[model samples]
Target: MSYAVPTTKKLIFDFIASRDTVSKGELLQVFDVTSSSLTRLLDEMTTEGILEASGFGSSTGGRKPILYRVNPIHRYIIGFEISRIGSSIFVYDLQLNQIAHVRWKMDATMTPDVLIHHAANQIESILQQHHIAPSQVIGVGIGAVGPLDQTDGVILNPLHFPADGWKDVAICEQLTAQTGIPSFLENGANTALIGEHWALRGEQIKHMLYVHAGVGLRSAMMSDGQIVRGAFDLEGSFGQMIIQTDGTRLQEGSNYGALEAYASIPALEKQVRTQVKLGRDTSLHPYAPEDIHFDIILSALADGDRLVTDLFHQTGAYLGIGLANLINVLHPERVIVGGPFMNADHSVYDTVIQVTRKNIYYAPDYQPTFSMGILKEDAVATGAAVMVRKAWDCE
Candidate 1:
């Protein structure tokens, strides 16, 4: 059984959670309490299975100090990522180790009610299969494409959901009501960034940027270890930023020639289809242009289809311009790009790097490293679980 974690206990756990292992002496130095008092708290935490003595620390002219760490199995967290293309759920231990995961493709049948009930049922199944008591779970954290009322825990009118009932849905409330577990909601991009931040806690990256290219482009920023939120939760606003003043394509409800009009996965498909109509020669000519999907495009890309490669290069250049603008303003220490568009040896990623470098303000001293997201497809779901951990720390 775990003991009640008051503010002080939570603080200690937070510190220990942030590191691989921490010494009792270090805890005493950090927290303002008598050594005996702190010792009693640590003893209780260890006895309750919330913390474990990992090993001994280096001796400082005395006996080696004992190290303590949050026991990975002491508690669990559930993370959910709801997207227009797909949705996923992840179960993680206190240490953010993935215990179980499930995913499903988004379709017309996946309305709000169906999705929530399915998620709730799956949570129960996973808990039973893993021999985890429902009480062991900390809470559920949901990351979805938004325009969300995060304070009210509602999914606002996000565009392009496969189903019609996505608007103004109290998703968190519904999930919690069904499962009897607390749930929190945030933008998927923010959650992905949060997850990346947690995974790289050892790296201590304070300023970071995360961009995801999928049905649409979504972005989130982390400044000084905190996820930055705008007055309104328009995480997809970056996608609407005008990239070309007189360019042809315009995303629904977005500015003419928006970045998303050119860089999004749907846009890539559209571009490919347009080119096919214009009789651009490629291996994809065998497939009906209208039937061409992201998977088909990727298949053609893998087969070295010149038409597909050229289109990807053009798409990457447009996205790079948007990224360059962001980098100049934010000056983040690192940028992580993710989504279906990213693949091994894809020209899109390579071209994005080249164009970004070509456009960004030149400075020998300023170098912001760019790479693909480490969490990949699991980023949002994993990050949602990490957000639950963060909430626990606050509590």
Candidate 2:
């Protein structure tokens, strides 16, 4: 079933969520509803604890109107971002402020049970530290590597992490049982898009795409004021879109000739390593292989190193091809690039823009805006928190 008085509640919720307080007249104008209707809804909401009259507003001539606001301190949320390198946990108040954060690297041999236990322990510690009651924690939102079955809260087969004996584990159910709270699981990239939406006033941007490029590339689509999770939540797996045909042999999980093979950070590092072995180098000679990260490549490009610049440009072009295809299909209003590689320098942006412009099928007047993500580095965590907030509102 849909939300009761969905339009009215949305208007009220958005107003209170975005501002410190609002007046009855303002609500009436914002919702474009009759005075009687607005009064009924506001009164109902105030009685339901969704909205509270905090004080009186300044009077213009007659009696002072009452000010109302959402109760920000009455609830809390826990957000988790699970990556191959490590996992991060954050406790956010109803207003989305981070009350606590914990980050710890995972042992390479850690199983799903062990990892979940560790996470549960960290969450319990944070809740205790903040003196937050278990009931006050509305939900736990998890952003994890995919392919995920969000409906079932199961991570089917993550590419990088060792699933081993952990296939089809019920992540949300397990976490919910462990923490005594509801849990929501989503693709990491999707979470990043949610985070961007929450952080950048996303209610205005009804259609947009968020591209996450780190060790691998994935994308999340937000269209018509909602995140699109296609057939079993596998909609935004752009990494599998084929882009090249000559570089390497195709594998099962690997997108044989996909843009990720050329544009991902690991791909760039491999390119640099190959150039070094071919004795065609510049400034990367002194550092070890471990030091050849995306940042190092960007630093080399900044110094006007021709090889690294060419690599970035090449990577950007490949990324542009993939994105251009996406634009032709989705027709979003904007595309926000995230992840460590896209965050490096303007060269990447310029290259992606130039190539996308040349390849896109849209008319000149229909060009979609492209920019870096608003919550670039912390998008996953922020999205997780937003997911929790959404869950709380639904309850």
Candidate 3:
């Protein structure tokens, strides 16, 4: 359901939401308003269950001041992540605390209609189970693979989908109609970075970059606390970065030796399959080359398979080369690298870091710290929810 909030209330809510507690005088000082007018506004919001008195604050002089906080359960937000590998739904309160969650794998059967219907059903079931009404739901936010028509909320023709009916899908309209709630869509990589940024708000890092390596390489950046979106909504364009001029191009129409040709999970799987087909002895030989998958390779690596380890080393080297180029150009304060495959293995991550440091341009007194996403698999979903809350605050 849509909520129409006055600009004054939004400013008040924004002030309170960013802090642990806010006194009425503090609000008055932050915003220019009469003492009696501010008191009335606070009273109205408190009566409306949007804000609650959370006891008193330390007194600078005279009596202690009454502090207030945004009611965490005032309204709920829904976040959905639709990716080629799987989809996840998460319910969060105004404070962005996740209260309910569900996830499901994707296959050829999970077409646009099928997946959206399932998501609507799950959302209904979650709200009912949590005793939250439809009116209490602020809106739904979706972070999905690109390229997306974000302004119109359409899923443009993204490549490598398991299903065939994904081209030009009106995902936001369908979701909003099915669930009777306003919905917003964004690129998955951007949402993931937003999610991580929210988690690290206390750190006050102004510049950051995020890379998610899965079926493809997706990336997003933030500078001076604002997300840096490109003219075109193509998050996977990072995959087209040419790391090697003479490198192999696995698919037609792809750049030779692009980042995806080496860093992505599909590329890693293809590498292993090709080596296995060439009669390279390894633990994964039990499965046919066509049947080999990313999970199978991970299992083989877990067992210390020599063939899988060598291929990972090569993949990490290429991935590091790509990261080096990005870091050198962007010079972000922090870089987060995580997705399905990145979170699954630490050895590959370590190798990528080593190679990136070896190849990255050295700038005096500049070193970008690299780490995996704190939210991990749930990063995009959580970020979607955060965006919804942010929109409400803006309104």
Every model's TM-score: 0.94, 0.84, 0.94
lDDT of 2 by residue, 225-285 (tens): 6888666655336877877675552245565676767777777888887887677767888
lDDT of 1: 0.87
Q: Rank the candidates by lDDT, best first.
A: 3, 1, 2
Give the per-residue lDDT digits (tens) of candidate 1, residues 1-395: 01244588888988999898999889988999889989988999999998999999999899999999989999999999999989999999998889999999999999999999999999999999999998889999999999898878899998888888888999988999999888999899999998888878888899999998878889999899888877899678888888789775655557888888988888999999999988999888888899998888988888899988888888888889998888888889989988877653456788888888787796557879888878888989988987788778533
Which pairs clash in the backbone of model 3? none
Better of 1 and 2 by TM-score: 1
Clashing pairs in 2: none
Per residue, candidate 3 scores C-alpha lDDT tens digits across 1-395 of 12355588888987787777899888888898899989998998899988999999998998999999989999999999999999999999888889999999989999999999999999999999999998899989999998999989999988878988999999999999999988999999988999999888879899999998888899999999888977899678888999888898757889998899988888999999999999998988779899998888889888999999999888888888898899998889999999876766799899988898887687546778889968888899999988888788532
Report the error of model 1 at residue 245, Å.
1.4
Best by lDDT: 3
Displacement of residue 4 (Cα, Å) in model 3 is 11
Poorest lDDT segment (10 consecutive residues) of candidate 1: 1-10
Question: What C-alpha lDDT does candidate 3 achieve relative to the native structure?
Answer: 0.88
